[model samples]
Target chain A: MTVAIDRATGKRRGDRTPRPGLGRRLKNGYQRHWYAYAMIAPVVIVLGVLVLYPLAYGFYLTLTDADSLNSARTIGVNEIEATYKFVGLDNYADILWGETAYDRFWSHFLWTVVWTAACVTLHYCIGLGLALLLNQKLRGRTFYRLILVLPWAVPTFVTVFGWRFMLADSGIINSALEALHLPAPQWLEDTFWQRFAAIMVNTWCGVPFMMVSLLGGLQSIDSSLYEAAEMDGASAWQRFRHVTLPGLRAVSSTVVLLGVIWTFNQFAIIFLLFGNTAPDAQILVTWAYQLGFGQQPREFAQSAAYGILLLAVLIVFTSFYRRWLNRDEQQLAI
Target chain B: MTTTTVTPAAGPAAPDAAPTATGPRRRRGRGAALASHGVLTVASLIALFPIAWLVFLSLGPDKDDYLHPGRIWSKMTFENYSFVLSETNFWHWLQSSLVVSLGTTVIGVMVAATTGYAVSRMRFPGYRKLMWVLLLTQMFPIAVLIVPMYQILSELRLIDSYLGLVLVYCSTAVPYCAWLLKGYFDTIPFEIDEAGRVDGLSPFGTFFRLILPLARPGLAVAAFYSFITAFGEVAFASTFLLSDTKYTFAVGLQSFVSEHDAQRNLMAATAVLIAIPVSAFFYLVQRNLVTGLTAGGTKG
Candidate 1:
């Protein structure tokens, strides 16, 4: 009746019942939304104090030249005020274009690109192949899955250590290569092999997640689609290309984006595998980390700048990737 | 969408139609099956060999046996294990890891569960923005907050405290679990929520008494995720926890590097110990992991 009257009465509430007062509406809103507000209060408070606060503080740090020697410090009963002056865009400028910064940033940036692309390509290909094989009615499928997923099942720190041991200068891998008279490169020592080792170890750790997710995507595709394709005389390759690829687009898109961002910012593998010594092999995230924590007289502003730049790169990439994904959806619709 | 769990078994049965492809194709299917098995065997071996080698290395009595590489098979012993157990801060590290992990899991899952339930059941103000915010949180790397977090934690005198570590980890784990659990909650039918409201139950009561019990699997997945994340986290734990007793396995293992070559054997033994329980838990929850992740992924 109130809905009917409101519709008939020029969008006002029923004339017989006036709208609540401002205070009353406030009370009503609270009553209606308090449960939701209460439920979210814990997370809101925690994220607010911990995450958002630091995030804001980090942004502030990026605008100044804060460092260990200059930043304000509290020593016992004495206080030292921060003298690091504001330097907007200078840290970014230095890292992005300054002469010495060019070599440091660009070299690390190039390797990071190569590392991400190689690892993601390997992960997707190996994961998809294994997934396709497992999608068949094969014997010992569960056994194969259990074994293949072992690297991911183990903690990354532990598996990386395992890889470190195996790839050591006189480790088993080189020993095996030596016995066979093949080239046994210094995996941990040499630059090329160190980068290769990092990517290989990361791929080993990353593939299981991709495989499992893609397997789920494969499982969810209707058998009727396959039958229809078979009826149309599609070849095995045709069916895979047309039906399987399109069907996996949803899962693959998300996973690949995640793979790129993850590989770009991957800290544990590089850190655990090479520690801080392999400056040449360090990714941008680890390099930023080293600046802030690893070095003496920590350069907080520069570290924060590097972090902010990485975040910007990811945000821009994600938005573009999302737009591209949506366009693909539109093209499919057309 | 929720039934992806049951589809894996039904999915592979499509191969029954593959053999009858006509055009002189063999109905035997032996070649394809054999090739699949062969490839899988090779892959499985590739995956398993590294872990197996670690276990083997952990048994060496001499610290430098790994360097020599040939004497390990002849002289394997549990000396490294006993040594790591008795001659180090293994128990304290284990306690710290478990405490921090469990604390993060408990706090992370509880907060996220309520938020998940709220966002699932209600369209309160900022509901749409909440989802976007949760997604954005994932994009933030640890580098963004480490220095400021150090300052904040130190200001509050929480640098060497488990409370500080758990709080920092909660920042990482909560949003992720919330996204995952929200997706899980969506899979549960809304009619149950309605029925609880009709029975004179308040929203909180309905959520607790009805929805929470049914959401056990989702809650378990969230718990496992949070636990594993806090367990293996390196950056925050390494930075904040300065003292050895406060160190998790990640920081503790890092300290082993400067202790020289004998610690390699000890590190192997310790690595095995660290990996075992976490891996066991992973195997237990791997099935739900796919479901939880994709649920949050596709929907969010």
Candidate 2:
């Protein structure tokens, strides 16, 4: 590519003689795109080193017994021939059906799906409502926007810890409920309430982004559409169903997809809230963390295998979404 | 500016017809609408209650004896803030956080802006392929990279250093920042760059003088986001920066939970202190943050 580019530059400069041939033409073509290539070099080099190499290295380490004890044992006979050494596909199989692995593959998969869906759905509902309310020419709009954005603005850990404290046995929410003569539900103790609190906190942090995004989307929908629907004597529900929903479809879909990916990979809330207390609170990523870093001789390959599985699932969903969007685009073009 | 009279597009000449739904009873519909909005506002306040509680708790007295369980007035004091600011390594950690987050923002935006411009406006081989690769990279859990990163940073003798944290944070930020900036760049016409190239300036000069200036708002948005991400990042910093002096404010606040003394008030005060800087920065750059966040979601 380099030689071709140089030759093309030479031809473009008219410094070369006739009969420069196909090679020269190819080089000239490359030269035309040289600056474009130059512009992209930093991206390739930076991403290649930091992202691609590490990702590949992560997979490589998965094939070897690169546990904590094998730090310096990169290449050796006994370690290689050991029963635990260099067993290709065994780690993956172990994660899939290993007795010791707390996460049954299918259950973790189901939990991930359920968790993602519940969080995103609740966030969207609350977010869309706020966007609708704020989109109005109302009083104290900026103040409300600032207030609503706080949950997302604060650091993830601080918000998680705050929720943990509030949900404690004798914390603020319980205290407030007691003062109000209302029953304080066991938020962090019961299995159902633990999940509920996690979802509530996660929704608090997640909803603001969607609200802001939908607010921007709402601004773009030509008010004339709504006005036209009104002139036709269409009800508010009918107008929203036809005009607002279609207008919000694109942004809402993007929000849902990104929300799923982020929520699935969330570690801070569940980790800090449960903190090794409830074994079932260990999601896929947190489980990976405990197995990889919580032990004396860490199982790096098993952790990597788990991460790889998560990545595979995400890729499948993303591609499925992309295909779905592409079909929509094609239909629109038609 | 004086108000100009423009004709209504298609609604009722007066706005009253739309607000009043097609009910025989106008009072009931209006009342229901008001009630629903009131309910929504109340629900939103409930959602926002934790931060409100955090603020009040920070201002509350130290969690010591004379623990009056019921009276809220008795808990109001400023001692926790004074103690948190004076006793702990809060100042040093705050300074470290500023350095690390600013470094990540500056480097991340500088790299992403140029590369995003190239990707969005310039055409070359493997351009589409590069975007696909970058997008796919986002799915992988970055925690998986921490151990290898630890090994590499350790070998480089950069353990517990701001330089090490900055580099890792900036690297993780590059993909998303670049992708968003590319979306922004796509909005700017290629003719701007073409005009620059036709004027005989080098591509780099054109980018700096022409494109970068025009993309300032977008760049501001990207930088704010990158800054916030780095500022709030805890996982890698906690794992990598082992020394106490090297801790960012995020982990420093966790120190209040010692084995012996659990100063809930002081910790809340510290959390409030850290949150103020973050929230202030967000408020300052909110316009850009909103734009950067909603980058690819909406068309117009």
Candidate 3:
């Protein structure tokens, strides 16, 4: 084989080889890895043009008085020759501190946080509960698992639309409540009910992901630990708290972090459910979409500012999450 | 390894060796099993009820049945499905969705496979940083890119075009697909590459001819994921494709409700139609989907 011949001659050649110049060695390394560069070139180029350039242009647009009507014309023309006036953080200032608009920003921010927190908390609880239940040996567990996971398999647009129909004032849920002589809250009209419905629908859509993730984590817990805990006269709650909780910590944290990001930025459920017209239930994402696309004289720059702010917040959270994950991996390794 | 032992031990029918176990313990086990089954049944019902109701509404005779939940099955018919299929532009939207989704899948998988191979197997400067950049792309909100993506697409005269939509979808899908493929490629041994090199194959040739076949499962996972993503995406597709006939099923379905009021039956039928293919695809690849998703989350 050529490989055997090369190996045989390579060692002999290495023994008498003279050191190469820096340029020669660098060239050799480049030659050896040229294919790697070629392989990744397309991805780098496409992402650069599509993702990175737009990202930079978006940041630029944030600094200008761009709108839906003007953004295309402004950015379409040469960047340097664009007619849109640069506002230099005025959009940010207006959204953050301009008295009337400030309330909108803060309220949306608060709802975004609340929405993300409630959804992630409910998702984790419901999902972990389901995982725990399903972990027990039971008849038709596989079928139950499959059925429970169907929500996730269904497209989110469909699920949200379905939930919207179900939660309508005259829909099945209210009808069922009325049948039982219970008060039926107006789900879409009232702010509190609207937010509740949004979170409930999101949890319905999200819990399967959590359940499957936690199920995997639960399955990975060694059974011997449970046996040992039982031998020590640990109660069921104690075993769960001491053993199961600890075992699931890493996976739970990851799931929660991801859940926070997704829920914070979730647009479809709220958008399709309320048609992006429910002001009382607006989170940051839909609010941004409304600013940019929902109304005439759309505030593209302001919405871009909102997006940048959301990105900044997420970056901070993600860095902390990455740190926690790294620490968890280290602890596991040790 | 532990699953084999743990399953039977926790099962209702304990082994004969446990005959000395107390009767109360056995009864308690049975009760616990019954309780679990009860909970599972309720949870499954809750999870599936909305979809079942949607299907029922889709099959119901008219919009009036939607208001009266009790009458869901009173007058069932297949007219709604027929109406959506024949009266609406549903088939047109379906074609657009399929073409865009398949195009994205093909391109997304090809680029991801090659890029993943490079990142996984080759020793190159900036490869680690490239991987991090790819991961970061996954974290960035799609909303942030909406304005710029719109501008870029418009500039390229691709705003209403399938090619433009496919490109945007590929941009979103490629990062995750590449990461998934790279994780898969890492599992493959390097000795195969060395052996291919010994056989006088170039790096690209080895990757294409030798490594790609071995990574079919990973490629399948990536392709399915990309297809589902492109198929179900509404935010970008809705924005970029402004024409009604050009709309993907997601946008088209959304328009059915937004544009036309009191079309719940037809809307539900359309939703069911949109969901069927995705669900079937999911069924075929559910196992790989779980592994791919968890792997991306935990590892990437």
Candidate 4:
């Protein structure tokens, strides 16, 4: 009713107004754009509250001793006198050096890098291979493609735990190995094998994305180029190298960047398989979870320190990607 | 939009590069091609082995029979399925998941649609900056946000609630949705809205009554993505929603296999049940997904 009222008032004024000058046109533009502004307001507000605030809060929380159980307290002036009162660099140092903190922080950090690298590389190799194979003309390609994508389509917890179960002592893998007169690797009991299992699970979850992306890229490639390469006396390898690979450059780069970020931050495969109980396999994210949720004497400051460190690494990666993208564009322009 | 044309290799000018056209030679080529395809087909099966193993385990003769599928079989049974269905709280948890996923999709689409429309069609100050900031948000690791988000949600008394999970899910989904939707909306002609305006409809009516109908495919894709994402996301659900009754199907299903006791067959059955609906959902929306993802690149 109020909206109608304002409309009627504006309509009455519309009949009596002399045509607006340049200044008034500018003003009218602002007035007309208001609805658009109003529509976008909620999105901006929600992002600010949920994303921006937490990011800022994460940075601030690093300087405080606000443990989950502690209820956000000050560490006092005497503690400050001892250089331990909400000190900024101390938490960073604690995470950097195993000195004032929880155990195996560095080990987890190293594992995180290795885990991400393995996941990304395996996903790329298998995914690109699948993309190339499926791109070829084949009978029952649709069915085969659908079956391959099943691992990715299923939810994470189900498949991650499913793999975990398969790796169990009396599980299918062990059973199959025993039947074949081969020794079953103690998949969960060992550190390196467990990490391999984690990577396998992560790769299982991740490859479909890369495959789909590469498929899209391959389909977009101009087939005439392949024919042209063949006419130039190029073998299959040369044609694929010169045509298909170059054709896929942009999509492939984007795939690698996205895969890196996703695998780097992947938590479920490791957390569900190993949890905090595995002293060796914990990543930064799982380590943070342990500090906050896994233990009683939770160290919020140290967790925040780890969180901040992870953010810095990711930010650096993002900027590097942006620069890489710009360079690619420039080269293409040339 | 640069269309660089490469000259064809096997065209009339380069006829010498062709393989021998003799029948026997062609037969051998076909045989080799078939062999290569056979190898790849086997490889594909091996790649899909885990899923096959899952299906077999679910339908195994008994819980122990799964450990020895090649050996003397006990018998096939629907007992695992019945055990997962009738004896467990899985159905209830599945219902919770459906509600939370559907709710997040609805809210996310609504918000992203309106925002995307505005950014695409309207002249607004700082709009570009806002878009960039939203993209920048994607750079932050979800792991980095975990602790602070937990604290904030805890403060709001939203922990262990559908509302918290939905909010978090929608927040993460909006940036990509909005980006994609904005790109989609830009491809729409502005003349349609102008025509609606001249016909005496309000700007709101122009969008709701005219533009939205045209953007239906885009909206469907966005909604489908949001739903699948909310449906699959387990980290936030497991972390935030602690109560057993409130737990989503994914998390609840995880509880089937604990530290000491694990019903591998029963868990497989439950997992199969979970996969059915999600797979069905994917199948239903499969066509739209390919179109949606490619739309961002092929269109302006």
What are the Cα lDDT values of the candidates?
0.82, 0.70, 0.79, 0.71
What's the candidate order when arranged by decreasing DockQ? 3, 1, 4, 2
Ten-residue segment with the worst summed lDDT in candidate 3 chain A?
Answer: A1-10
lDDT of 3 by residue, A103-134 (tens): 67998888888898899999998898888888
TM-score against truth, every candidate: 0.90, 0.86, 0.88, 0.84
For every prediction, compared with the true complex, DockQ reads 0.39, 0.29, 0.40, 0.31
TM-score of chain A of each: 0.87, 0.83, 0.83, 0.82
Global Cα RMSD, each model: 7.3, 7.9, 7.3, 8.7
Cα distance off (Å), candidate 2, residue A138: 2.3
Off by over 4 Å in 4: A1-36, A72-85, A98-103, A180-183, A230-234, B1-32, B60-66, B70-72, B121-124, B186-206, B294-300
lDDT of 1 by residue, B221-285 (tens): 98998888788888888789999988999889888877553368888899998888889989988
Ordered list by lDDT, greatest first:
1, 3, 4, 2
Output the lDDT of residue A141, model 1.
Answer: 96
Q: Across residues B1-300, which tens digit of lDDT does each residue of candidate 4 receive? A: 211112222121111112345565355446545654775687567667777677777887455655576652456677889887888887789888988999998888887788888866665677657766765665566666777888788767798899888888877888767766876776676678778977988778888999899999899888888888788776678788888888897688777667216766788888888888888778777656755754443331
Alpha-carbon DockQ of candidate 3 = 0.40
Candidate with best lDDT:
1
TM-score of 4: 0.84
Off by over 4 Å in 2: A1-29, A73-84, A100-105, A178-185, B1-33, B64-72, B258-260, B297-300
